[model samples]
Target: MLRLVTTSLCLYCQRAQVTPLLLTRPHSVIFQEENQLAVNALYDLSVDISKVRKLKGWVLRQSAVYVSETAALLRDMGASGPVIARVLELHPEAILCNPDQMEAQKKLWMSVCASQKDLVGIIEKFPASFFTSSSDHDNQKANIAFFQTLHLNKRIISKLMASAPHSFSRPVKQNEEMIQTLQKTYLDLGGKEDNMKIWLQKLLTQNPYVLLKLPNALHDNLAFLRNVGFTSDELLRLLSKLKGFVTELNPESMRLTLSYSEETLGCTDAELRQIVLQCPALLYYSVPILADRFKGLLAAGVSMEQIMETPTVLELTTQIVQYRIQKLRSFGYDVRSGSLEVLNGTKKDFEMSYGKLRLRQERPLFNPVAPLRTED
Candidate 1:
């Protein structure tokens, strides 16, 4: 039995007129289990309930019982109120009270009410109307109460979110090591200054998805830095030199960057050509259609800038075919896949060797499969 050592009067035991157990002797009651390990199970907790001391006052005792029962029920329902409250009690300072937290709460509530009509009905019909008039302070309080009511077993969620405010406000430090590694590798490989920029751009474009995994504030800062030309070719060359010494790495990991230059600065044919001049490795093996488009555009007196912005000649031709296919499909006609290929092959031969596509009516051959026999 647990002993109470107190100078002040124990009100609970006073009401029951029962003596608070003193651990002077080694007398053991049924409450003191010989098999202490058995208490690990809930069934053990239930088995020993009879030996537990009852609280004074029927109303208070009944309320305590009901609360305990409800808490257990909520636990089984996967709702966690008591645990949330305990977590908050443990780290009251971490509780969100900022304007951003308030905004988040408002957004959460809005989304919940909008998507869940049943939740709306429950909120409206709940006996106390708990959610009806939630002021900012009340909202925060209610949020705490709601979490506490969920009966969460562990304080994992609370602990995880506890450091969020600090994390959100702080900027992540740039990895100088990665920058150095990139520089060393490229410079050691004899990559020219101009080539590094092209390499970086290519890396950024092909791996735009990297931005999503990055911490947002840091990513925004990096984007800003890039805009101001912080990621210059000179810096990249220096970093490339640093990369030569670093081993046991893919070397391309740090290359995963956002490709803002593609859409913003515009990766025109001229720019691509510049990259190719600096780094021949960057060139595609086959871009015949692209080359032809540029050639045609140039021949037609179209400026390189204009041609770059407009769809390529091959792309435009493909678009035309696609438009025709879509129109035909809309009119209850299905296109066979190989039909376009045959037409394209014919058109290619005609346009290059003979002439452009022209209307040519062809004589039909005698049908091998005759029309179905019609009888009156």
Candidate 2:
């Protein structure tokens, strides 16, 4: 019984702790009293209507307060008079309100409430529902898509437009053809994925100023640029540049010059012009470095197609260094310390050798033969 009272109080406290914003919005106040003291307090607060007969009569307003337990307390004769009825009207008493106890009585009802144990079960199920593992390849693809779909800017797209015209162009009739082209490019470049992504992203983010000049550049070019590693910063830069260009160039002239081209992969001559017009800063480091790197990688026994899918020179350099070290170790070379030193087997020979031992000859300590010769 004591446990029941405690649970009721806890539940009531939870309800009471709700923000007053939600509570005050209602027209009436409602409260439940389980304690004898609370009931007594309510009785003391009730008005004595018999003593206030001389008072000018006003229509008594009905109270909406209700109680679901301790209805017997309403008939306390030792306390205040008939005004108890008025208080009851304002604050009705409940016959029974212990929902927890009532629920235990109904065998047909399932447990309607979540207990701490049930919460644990829910939390346990969450891992099965929400957590999943994916391969590195899938993760990379997801990351690529994430960056592409992200709210990137026109500047980034414009830069991409300048370089990846084939990629930035209109949709092909067959996705297989597009995939084949990508694969061919990847193969041609010796499978350098990182280089391809970098170069493509460079074009996509060429210039924000140019992007404004060629509004459709980014929108059309994103698919191809995604193949390359386009970053959010590049996209933002492009958008900023595009906005600047929009302010500088005439809208109609911009439209006419950037008219769509099927061959340029849906990017317009105007877009290309816009890119070049605003190209000074963007082209300075990005475009040239990208082209040179791509070409260098391509020239060095890497196919252009393979270059599109393979790692960059820097990445490959590290991998190659590792591989070389592995090969050297496999071939019986001391990779940790590059050079080798040989030591003789005898104590004297080893002592005299440079590795693992050192020896200093002490002269005259062996003067036994000389002393004997002198004595003779």
Candidate 3:
């Protein structure tokens, strides 16, 4: 009897252990079926399955119904098949969004977009922008309303939504503070009220991301420039040239670049200011890049004075400078003896200069009074 009781107890413990596995087996199979179905649906859409697997495997675990639903909504919105596939592939998280949330997002976007066709185009180009989290929907709506109150063009608002969506994800107060700071800075820098609205619109159009920057960044950069001896008029001009990118710069980085440039060019404070004014890129390019460019010019027998006279040459890469130098040398127009201005411009400009030099070389320095006879 004792042996029989011990055996029965062991059997009961074994059965208990097996019960949970038996219960979970069906659920695991259901998940696998769902994942496989999702994968098959996406594969049918011509999405690059290998990329989705590597970058967003979680998308497979989502319900196949959601994937199909999202794709169907995009199709209904006039998105082409390829565009829908590209959108899903680029932003797999979009599959997790529910139907109502997507509709709400679509409606919000349509407010700024000129038409459903335009909205579809924006979505096709910037899929991630259109598929932002539902939690940001309120903030996005608020930001759009605020921008409209500022009298910004619908086209500009559309661009901001597509290119700088994160700017809309923040609280309206954050954006409002930044805008107020810009306005104050403009007026303080001698900008007139009549031109402020146009100035703001142009600046925003040039760089919508500027609104994302901290207000203090603009303040600090302007203060640094003022300390560097830029008068009110000159500061306003520099701001216009930078196109609101000054907000992206901190005083520390500008100080470092200015110091390095002053030391490298061996110029006084006033002259350094003038160089920066002439070529805003001096404030933008990194030290190592600037060093390499200066080294390349000096290595090729170009004088520092020539670079000072034409600061824009620093914008060219070392390889381009070398290529242009060689091309000029082949034409007997040595850059060392000639002006560095010859090496500064687009490929077309360089080619035009080369063609003119070639013509000059082919022409006779002293033509006789008689016209040269052509062979028939």
Candidate 4:
């Protein structure tokens, strides 16, 4: 079982020995023991009943009046109940933490992203942002420098940090070792040093969790793609275009997705590779979504070859494909054979081409000078 410990409790446990009753009993069974003391630590906001329920652990020791001044600070700064609840869930000790520690966390959040609306995005992504320690602060600076070496700007780095604060929570050396290992592995795979930097930057900037991915995952993705007919040159382009390719992709699922697309589109594996090479994102789309678009296009009389030529149409929504195709067909135009322009042209552009925009009728504007006092 994963050893669950609150950030503050972990610090305390290190210095002092206390086994504290373990709530090892599955959470569902806990309600039967209603007589057992409930442990709710965070303070200030009224918590959700469900949240109150998740806070079920045996009383380690009676916590003193735990004031989450930091949580209060966020509420003061426009954080809502859900947001504060998430903060507590991610770091239960945030409520028990010293005022200064909470302040540092709030400050870090502002530094990374200040907009209250934006806070929901980052906080939801990295709730552990409020758990920074002195060493964590030092490591954060070093981590920034390390990412900067990959040519990421402060804004992107801030976004990355928001998304994966806990990933970079560990010491900087651990991350450094991982990056070095990845770089060496890429070189061993016959990747060019200059190109490897670009690919690595693309991957990490979009999905920093990929950095913490199982060490063999990168090699596996590369090998898997190559075996599935991605040529060496095409693989570089694939990595360049699909930033989350390595981090988010699953090998078995990708093979299934590829096979499903090939069968649905009535294309051979080579033809599938051609379209995927044109639009790398095709591989990322779920099989159902891919099928929906493919059948919609087939219904519109768009040949498989046309799809292969206009790979980007696969990226468009089913509604867009159907709407554009129907609109063009109504106007006696060939929706199937037309280039991307058929699918891409805006409504205004269509009106302009149909000679409607310039001729659009509107009520005549009256002279503002009281019609020059001419009643007639």
Candidate 5:
């Protein structure tokens, strides 16, 4: 009788333990089943499943097979299997988008795009741009209409939508305010009214995200530049030269870069202005990068005067400078004694210069037009 009692107690304990486990099992099984569905769907679509798993595992936990919906949409848009797979791989969040929302986005994009082919190309290149939240659809449409009223070319608007979707995703009022600020700044700096449209288009093309910045950023930077002694005309010229990137700069960063360049180049404020005018990179490049480039040049026997004369050399990396110097040395041309202009330019330019030097060396010193004989 005691044995029977002990057996009953053991059976009750086992049931108690299993009851809790059974309760939890259904939830986990459902999650695993959903994940498996996503995995299978992606595998069928020929996507890089490993990347999806690694970069966006959370996408698999949803109950729906979003990958299939997204893939079908891409296929209907004339995207090939490889392109569809690539788009999904690059932006797995695309799978999480609602099918109806994606369809609406397709029609909205088609309005801007010349054809399905162009739309497909844009989607292939910028998946995230196309797969933005459905909630922003209204704002995007309003912004597109607003840009149209501004007389921006449809192609430029399309480029903006693809490259800077966040700008279009915002309320039209925000973009309008930013545009007004830009226009006011331009006119205040003596920009011609006749050239305003072209200027705005060029600026937007150069940096569409510029509109995303607050109007205060443009105001603050201009104020700082004026305080630093740049006249209105100089500021206008600088604005034109920067291609609308001036708004991206803040006073503190600019102050540090200016101070560093002024001290490193041993130039007065006026001279530094000229240098910045010649190479706006002096403003764009960070101080550490400038310092490294300067150190590389000075160590290579290049004088500060040479660097000032060709400020573009600062664009070249230290490794490139060293390689070019080595190539010039091989040609018996010493950069230390020659102009830094020879070191500047693209790789093709350097190769052409090197070829000329090689030809000059191969030519006989006394003979002006004699061909050199080659041994058989």
Candidate 6:
């Protein structure tokens, strides 16, 4: 009777809290047979023993079948002990799931991204997406169907899944409605009504997280921008190229920025529109950053038209601008006073051009003439 009561108390402690009484007092453990079996099983699980003891109830309950078959199945599927342990820790309900069902879930995710490391990475980032249930598979299928409707290539879809695993778990109806509405709005507002397929492709290229924003939220955001003096065309053009701005900027912050740009920063309304249309992302920049870039442009002898045309120059980070400008200065090329095209080129293009010039400048001057060899 005393052993029965102690066993019930220890089991209750394991279920209710962090540590079982037996785990706290190892020598006092009356269930040595079960404890040894569990401890040995979990030690090979590659998780800290101390931590595993906290989940002794679950560890032991699943240990028998898991040690004999379940774990072997995971190992056979090429999942390392650490990855399996982490999956269990994050989703302990997985222990109760059938081993065959768990194996199927692992295979499903692997099919999305063939790389085992990437599968492990997504699992680490988001274990909920890889649930072993029929509903999970249904949601994943719907998400894949939605992406397919957009006509995105398989590689891009794989990257999207790897980067945002939840993309595969979101409600299909919600994402489908949001994307369809957004596409219609883009065509109507951006003047790309004639070529929607291309516009959506461009939007996806610039912002793969397109489904992150719902249609109503986007409509509300566009309404705010329209009130802030953006014409339909300007809004469309800006959103097409600056896909992240909608997710980043809100109406309240946007109004303050518009007021600051026109009232304080001395940018005319037309100039503000041009700036945003040329670089919609500029709307998301802080007033101080916008001001600094404006001042930097003036200081560098950059023309207003040049700044308007190649607004991405304003998108460069402070460090990048300083480093590249200084590097160009060292090469006797005055980028500030020179054509703005150089500033707008990508880092790789700039590197290829400037790196060669720098190498030439650093090269030691060699004379082709050899000293005449006289008979000596």
Against the unseen true structure, what C-alpha lDDT does each candidate score?
0.32, 0.31, 0.82, 0.63, 0.82, 0.63
Record all residue pairs in model 6 with backbone atoms less than 3 Å apart, i.e. clashing. Answer: none
* Candidate 6 wrongly placed segments (more than 4 Å): 1-101, 110-137, 149-151, 190-198, 201-208, 227-231, 263-267, 292-309, 356-376
Give the per-residue lDDT digits (tens) of candidate 5, residues 275-330: 88888767877889989999999999999998888888888999999999998888
Minimal lDDT window, size 10, model 4: 30-39
- What would the TM-scores of all predictions be? 0.17, 0.15, 0.83, 0.61, 0.84, 0.64
| Residue 266 lDDT, candidate 5, scale 0-100 | 96
Stretches of candidate 1 exceeding 4 Å from the true structure? 1-174, 208-376
- Could you give candidate 6's per-residue lDDT for residues 48-67 as a string of tens digits? 65654466445443322233
lDDT per residue as tens, model 2, 283-314: 22333344454444434444433322222222
Off by over 4 Å in 2: 1-20, 25-194, 200-376
As a TM-score, model 2 comes out at 0.15
Regions of model 4 farther than 4 Å from truth: 1-68, 71-96, 104-128, 131-152, 170-174, 185-199, 263-270, 286-289, 317-320, 323-334, 340-376
Residue 50 in candidate 2 has what lDDT?
38
What tens digits encode model 1's per-residue C-alpha lDDT throughout 177-257? 333344444564467766665554343234322212333333333344334343444334422322221122222222221
- Per-prediction backbone clash count: 24, 57, 0, 0, 0, 0
In Å, residue 152's CA in model 4 sits off its true spot by 4.3
lDDT of 4 at 92: 51
Model 3, residue 187: C-alpha shift (Å): 1.4
Rank candidates by TM-score, best first: 5, 3, 6, 4, 1, 2
Expressed as tens digits, the lDDT of each residue in 91-180 for candidate 4 is: 554433445555665666565454665765566556556455445765676776777787766567777777677666777777777677
